[model samples]
Target: MTTITSAQAYLVDIDVETVRTDAVQAFLKQETVFVSITTSDGLTGVGYSYTIGTGGRSVLQMLRDHLVPRLEGQDSSKIEAIWMDLFASTRATTVGAITSLALAAVDTALWDLKCQRAAAPLWKVAGGFRRDVPLYDTEGGWLHLSQDELVSGAIASRDAGWGGAKLKVGKASHREDLERLLAVREAVGDRFDIMVDANQSMTAAEAIRRAHSFEPVDLFWFEEPLPATDISGHERLARATTIPIAVGESMYSIAQFREYLERGAASIIQVDAARVGGITPWIKVAHLAESFNVAVCPHFLMELHVSLVAAVPNGRYVEHIPQLRSITRNEMAIKDGHALAPDTPGLGIEWDPDAIDDRRVA
Candidate 1:
């Protein structure tokens, strides 16, 4: 059995080209916490977790001071057991960002180590549903863009052969949001899907009213219109609107997803690997959503999600947001309208060691 010898963590800050804004906040930067684990057998595995613009230091410290020490001498192949140990050891920080994000770095690295040991790519090793999943563009549709910019962006996405485009909603005037959606719909025509994300900015009643107004444009999914805690609000909104209600990015616990799924509050499960703990729990959430016949279109880290989404039968779409370009060798490939799962062994991510070293913040 390969025994873990050491684990290390660091942080990198990736600057966004255009400041990404939505209803709640501006995504000024992406802070990724990278973790690498080495075993006695001389095998090394790397993994990472992210925050929008903060908390990278906290994730790094949690990994170094608390979680990494526990991994010493453990069997690297036992990913689930290791993940559970991390989950249990960090009980005080469980069901929140710091613990979950820290666990993600360790758990994902273990999975990578396991896959590398097997000499198989992550998609096939994970489950191998399909190599290609349809793509939806959110990069071009930030809420800060003008209506013309939004329409042009939708047109560009359609021209580039993406299946859908997501527009940020929750403007002060529902009329302004409606105008932008209508413009995009008119530009992209009836065939291409148009998804809308409100980023949990509205109350239940406002969300219901806005959902009804958006029906005329034929939205693909209504994402995070109400706060994640407002299960009853989401249920009310889901019942009032024909459009599917998608949720889960901000949710830090799997039990939170269960509440929404069992209650029919969220029709599309947008489980983010880092936020949900790691690939281990991420897959559990995917299967949980699958059992409910809900679509799993995960939130971020599309580099990793491409493989995870392709592994599960019910995974519907991969959000096309390339966040790790500055420190990674390959951007995930998109052909026709779908993102292709990488055939590279061990999580399909090739970190440029020098690039990562240059940007190290911790």
Candidate 2:
């Protein structure tokens, strides 16, 4: 057995190019928690998770003080068993962000090691459903951007042959949101898919009202209109809207996804591997969504998500946001509106150690 001989974790603060705003908050920075593990045989694997701004130190501490020690002497190939042990250890925080994020870093590192051992790429190792998954842009649209900026960005994305682009909703006035949507729709015409995300900022009633207002523009989906935990509210809004309801970024567990899926609260699954405890539970949630005939369009971390999305039959779209560019050597492979999964062995993140070291926080 390949025993894990050593494990280490660190925190790095990544700067955001612009003020990323949704209805609830502005993204201040990205605090990334990176984990690396080495086996007795000398192979090494690295993985990471993130917080939009705060709480990265907590995740790093969890990995170092609690999770890393437990990983010592464990078989690196026993990914599922290791994950379960970690999950059991963090029972009190099983369904929370800090625990899940910590687990994700460790779990992903294990998978990377496992894949490296087998000499296979993660998409093939996971399932190999497709080499390419469709791409959509979330970076182009922010709630704080002016209507002209929004239109120009959408047009640029469309001209570049991206499948679609997302727009942030939840302005003070519903009419303002509608007007922006209309402007973008008129600029891009009916061919381009436009997804609207409110970032879980509305009441169920407000969501339902906004859904109706957005209907005429031919929106691809209305995302996170209400809060993430409001299952009943989501169900009501889902029933009231014709546009597909996309959610799952704020969700931390498969059980929470089950609750949403069972009640028909979400039509599109936006499960985040970093938040859902890495590729292990992320796959469970994806398969669960598949069983329900729902599409999986994961949120953020496009570099890692592209491979996972391409690995699953039900995987739909990969959100385009280049948050890790400075620290990674390769960019996401985008061709003809779709992202091609990396053929390299392991998770495919080419970490620039010097870059990460330069940005290290704690």
Candidate 3:
């Protein structure tokens, strides 16, 4: 029986090269928290979680003060049990970002250990549904970009063989948003997919109004138009428009996703592995979405999400928001409009220890 011998947590702050502005907020930096676990068999696994520009220290504290201590001497293979126990120990913070993020760091490390022990890549070990998932570029679609820049970026993504590009909506005027969408549509032509995300900046009535205006452009999906908590608003918007409502990135638990799925509020499930806890619960959420006949196009952290997307049958697209390049040794593999899952075992991320150490803040 391999037992966890040690568990440690660290924090790093990585800056975004380009300004990333959406409707709701500006992403200043990635406050990444990492957990490293060593087992009695001498196998070590690393897992990580992140916040856009805040809360990394809190997540790190949660790990150091509560979660990591409980991990020592536990059976390394009992990932679910460990996850539940840690979660229950932090019951006051359950179903929230801090607890979930801390659990993600530890839970993902356990998954890394599980994958290494089996001698298989995470995608294959997790489900083996597909090796490559279609790619969509959000890097070029930020709301801060000029209309011409947006058009050029869409065309550029198409030229590079990416399947789709997402545009940030929720501009000052509905007409302005429509104009930009129309311009990109006119430039990229009819075959390419174009998506729009409001970043949860609109109300139910406003979202329905904007969805009506956006219908002529043939958008692939409308993402996070209303706050994630507004399930009834999303339900009404979903019924009011032909465009599919996509959400789940802001969500923190499986039960939250179930509410959206059962109410027919979300058509595409964008489950972020870090935000939803870790690969354990992330996979559960994916299977749950599959049962509802919904496709998953998870939010950011492309390095991790690519494998998760490839591991599930219903994973439709991997959003391309390259945020990990500075701290990782390799870029995600992209070919012919798709992101390929790494064939290597143990989470599939080639983390640069030296770079991580240089950026360590905790």
Candidate 4:
């Protein structure tokens, strides 16, 4: 029996590669929280979750004060049981970001151990549908960039063999947004896929209007036009436009996703593994999206998500927003414009311990 012996959580702050702006907020830094779990059989697995800028300490505290204690002496092989136990332990904070993020940290570590124990890479262990998932560049598209910059970025991505590039929308006027999308569309040509995101900055009515205006560009998808809680609003927007509504990055529970799917509010699901809890529930959400014939295109944490997106048949494009390079020794493997799932065991993230120590905040 590979019983858990101990769990340790660490917090590290890594600056964003560049200025990352969206309709709602400017990304300050990545406040990454890492959880390392050791088993009785002398094995350790590392798992991590992140906040855009703040809340790392809160997540760390959650693990130290609540989650980690429960991990001691638990069976490392029982991933689902342990996830449920942690969820039940934090019942009061269930279905919230901090709890979910903390749970993800520990839950991922367990999965890392599970994969290592089996001597299989995560993509294969999870359900190897494909080894290489399509890649779409999001780092080049930010609300802060100029129109010229956006166009150049899209062209660069397309020329580099990427499948798509996502542009941040929600400009001051619908005309401004349309102009930007049109500029990128003209530069990238009709064959290259272009996606637009509002970062949940508009109302249902405003989103519908923008969607109609953007129809000429043939966008791949329209993402997060309204706040996550507004399912009815999303439903209205979905019915009002031909563009597919992509959501789930802000959602913290499976129930929220189910409601969106049931009401036909979303076409593409952007469920973030950290926000939704961990790989355990992440896979569940992917399967749930599959049941509805919706595609799973998860948001951020691309290093980890590359394997995840490759794990399931319904998985779509992996959004490229590289934020982990500073603290990690390896870059995600890419070939022919696709993010390849690492064949190495145990989450496939090569953490530089010295670099992590240098950035460690708690």
Candidate 5:
């Protein structure tokens, strides 16, 4: 055992107001959880687990009542083994929701510890394949924004030098979706790379229909049009439309990504390091995508995604959503529409306990 002497989870509150070209919304007002591991040798690492809203409380319960107890006296170096044990321990409890979220937090903390001990950036710990990645502003796609607002966000991202842009689709009707896309095209011009996220809001047939509607503008691809589990459906839709497909945030494991890739399901893979069992599995997915000549563009966790995307030669673009700065004292590194990797130690994040504590629920 590597001798981890202490562990604790904090329920940090997040309240960030995001003002985009479109409508403004408070990205989070709920609690976000962070797990900190301290080694007997005086090493420490911190990692976060978040639920978009109120569900963070349940993840907090799992960490406090269940996961934390298991970490006592274990060596922090055995991150892979620890993650597997926790996943298996919560098998019955986490077919979905809070349990899996808690597992992600602890797993990430262990990786943070490993990288810190090695004195390298995450991409170096994982293996540095690239240093900078093209980025796309993901702000244009939220459901709450108006069409003009969505178009405005797309234009702003383009003006900022982003290589691509993505907007939300599946807005109750194809007519509305077409209108938004057209508005964006007019705002940013027809030649720019544009993408759309259905957010798993459509059926396979609906995805195909909506994709065809934007065929003229040469969209980057349609993201998560159908649910993540429906490989056959995604395959069917791929054959039906010339538009390519993008997926991954909805997927939690490399096994699931392999299933999608093996079937030629998505031309673009969008993995989230925090969501898919931390940096380990996410790196594995990047390698898998490489063998297929596919593009690996990750979803959120932009603070962390910058490193992985920059480390992969075949990486596509990092999703840029600037909502976390209000909660964290430091901003994510982005310039010229590219997200820069952190030169700081660990994951380059220091928890703002006071800022985070301010937003906690009663």
Candidate 6:
């Protein structure tokens, strides 16, 4: 067997047709995280990780400065040790969107390498849990979207075959958010599943207040009502509202997610594979959430999450945000509405090398 060798980073602007904007923020530009890992025998595996708007530079810096040094000239097969090294090196930064963003890149690259070596898609290597996960269309739930726009988007999503759709909430006032949600509910009607993402904008009282207002609507779940750190707040919101409190897109590790689960903080768990270390940790999260009988609805990376959700029994929905269409060789397939996973080697995440050639940060 060949010993592990070198790792390098590349900064690419994955061209997207449009910037995905919502109450959270805007993409502003096309960007992605690309990593190359080479073994002693000359077998190189390519992996991918990405961020939406901010933190691209930080991801590159972390890899160029802190992470690559530890992995260079080491056995790539020793994944666990390398993961530990990276985790410890960045521990001082602690876990947040930033740390998790960096880990997402490295972990993704490593998984690509592993899949290439084993000659299997990520779903198989990670243990083929399922082939079909429930799908939800994220119809660009922008903060700027008017009530009419929100209703139209939801109906369009339903018409397109999506099982549900996520709408943005958390404006300046809880009452305002309710008015918008009610309009959307009236448009989409009672049969469709309507979820909401507050994007960490509300205080606990506001989250509770807004949640109660949506009770007549039969909401699918309430997402990111408050900061990920305030576990007690989330628990309070969960207990106070009949609506399910869903979190974990900003959370980075199993330990953190375990805390959410232990506290009964979330009824619907939205784990981001990129944010929660990588496929390894993401799978760990899915299983842990399953043990508690919590629903698993992974955040973003719909192309990646489709496969993951299919493999996990409790997996719920893969968010469908069609922003990576220009850069990816295979844009996630949408039939009616559910996003379909590609049956290809690795993650089925091959980008147009030439399209990324003109990528620019400035």
Q: How accurate locally, in lDDT, is each candidate?
A: 0.91, 0.93, 0.95, 0.94, 0.79, 0.78
| Model 2, runs deviating above 4 Å | none
Candidate 6 local lDDT, 23-78, one digit each (tens):
66765754577677777877776666677656778887887888877777777766
Which residue pairs of candidate 4 clash? none
Question: Alpha carbon lDDT of residue 146, candidate 6?
Answer: 80
- How far residue 324's Cα lies from its native spot in candidate 4, in Å, is 0.8
Q: After superposition, how far is residue 66 of candidate 1 from its true place, in Å?
A: 0.9
Clashing pairs in 2: none
* Per-residue lDDT of model 3, residues 82-178, tens digit only: 9999999999988899999999999899999999999999999999999999999999999999999999999999999999999999899999999
Instruction: Please give the ranking of all candidate structures by lDDT, highest first, separated by commas.
Output: 3, 4, 2, 1, 5, 6
**Per-residue accuracy of model 5 over 1-362 as CA lDDT, tens digit each:** 55788898877666545533212223455357888889887888888867655777788888888888899788898888888888888888754657767887887888888888888887667677766778887766676788888878888888988887887776667888788788888889866789987777778877778878889767889888888889999998888888889999878778888988899888999988766767767788999999999999898778888888877888878888765676777877777777787766577675666776676552
Which stretches of candidate 4 lie above 4 Å from their native place?
none
Clashing residue pairs found in predicted model 1? none
Tell me the tens digit of each residue's lDDT in model 2 across 1-362.
99999999999999986679999998989999989999998999998999998899999988888899899999999999999999998897777999999999998999899889989999999999999998999888999999999999999999998889999999999999999999999999999999999998999999999999999999999998888989999999989989999999999999999999999999999999999999999999999999999999999999999999999999999999888888889888888889999999999989898999999989
**lDDT of candidate 1 at residue 208, scale 0 to 100:** 94
Which candidate number maximizes lDDT? 3
lDDT of 6: 0.78
TM-score list, all predictions: 0.99, 0.99, 0.99, 0.99, 0.91, 0.92
